[model samples]
Target chain A: MKDKKPMKSVFKAGAITSEFIGNSIYKHQTKTSIGAHNIFLGQVRADDIKGKTVSAIEYTAYEDMANQKFHEVRESAFEKFDLTCMHIYHSLGTVKAGEICLFVFVSSPRRKVVFEALEFIVEAIKADVPVFGKEIFEDESHQWKLNS
Target chain B: MLITIKYFGQIAEVTQKEEEQLEVSKGSVSGLLNTLNTKYSDLKNKDFQIAQNQELVDLDTELTGAEIALLPPFAGG
Candidate 1:
């Protein structure tokens, strides 16, 4: 259903509310045989590198680019897999370290495709999207995380 | 035409400013970077990247009035 609204990432300081992603997940499912649902949630870890404790993650993206990439990812998934529905939502700003950064949900008529679709969407988001984040540390020192 | 470009993160640090305009024949992204490298040699040795309208682009990608941004390696988890 194209009219079903896609989820918007909760880009804010502190924690992400379930509603941001839950709504989209709810819309994606219908009472069909669709046997499996797979979800991946990415949480920011308080990684301590070189004595710096990552306090928060500030997510940024070129809106135009990211939206385009999102549409492309959706299309590729439809072409590459046998799926019922899929949803991807990534935070855009200030997700505190240890909070959620991204959420991916995939549902399919069969179990096998959900796994493949989950992996595919996650990898695409990491590699192709124009999202950038700054890992802010306790001491306020920051570092960039490469897609690699 | 003079096209204004924006820089973020390490790119801003090196350029010492947020935005500036470059005069060119709406050339390729690589050509612009080359001109910038000629003026600021530090870029030649750094890990900076180019984006046109926020999409990561190859060096040879052509630019035509697109909003350009220079970004260093990302730090998002």
Candidate 2:
């Protein structure tokens, strides 16, 4: 977190479902000015580590701090890109492999802007957010995940 | 000063609790960490960052008795 002023945004519980993502896109249909939309979905990978295969990831965060960081990322994205709208959601609790855990949606008047804005926002979230993940193996053993 | 400290991810695992309050002398963040290392011996070996209030602070920064957090390497996507 970069700022002491905490911004409040509730964390989403469980995996992000396709239905939820669909509904989000459905709602955006009313914003006709947005000519292009780009999305980034972060899915849990069943990675193998030391002979153990990951079955799920349990995410946790310093919620108040994470909210504050998210606020900064959002504010900076708006300032740097001409985005018509932006949305981000990250999962708390256990998300199994193949399930979506992070969703970033960005829209703009032009295709190029949406593409660039989406990449910028996604990279910022990875580097700045305080969210942590515990990669749970099939046998119940787990290890903390690190951003590469 | 009474300081509140929070632990997350692997740091919480080492500390064995998520949050705690301690009565400590006002000092640099590293000084407070020295006290914590004595209490939680594994904390010194863990990879983490210190946050004073909610902002990330280095070890040399003075503690302000605000809410502090020990954060491990981030995995947020």
Among these predicted structures, which one has the highest lDDT?
2
How well docked is model 2, in DockQ terms?
0.89
The lDDT of model 2 is 0.90
Runs in model 1 lying further than 4 Å from the true structure: A1-15, A19-33, B16-20, B38-41, B53-56, B74-77
Candidate 1 residue pairs that clash: A133-B75, A133-B76, A144-B75, A145-B74, A145-B75
Q: Quick one: best DockQ, which candidate?
A: 2
The regions of model 2 sitting more than 4 angstroms off are A1-10
Model 1 / residue B24 / CA error / Å: 2.4
Residue-level lDDT tens digits of model 2 in B1-77: 99899999999889889999999898899899899999999987899988998999998899887988999999997
Docking class of predicted structure 2: high
What is each candidate's DockQ, to 2 decimals? Answer: 0.47, 0.89
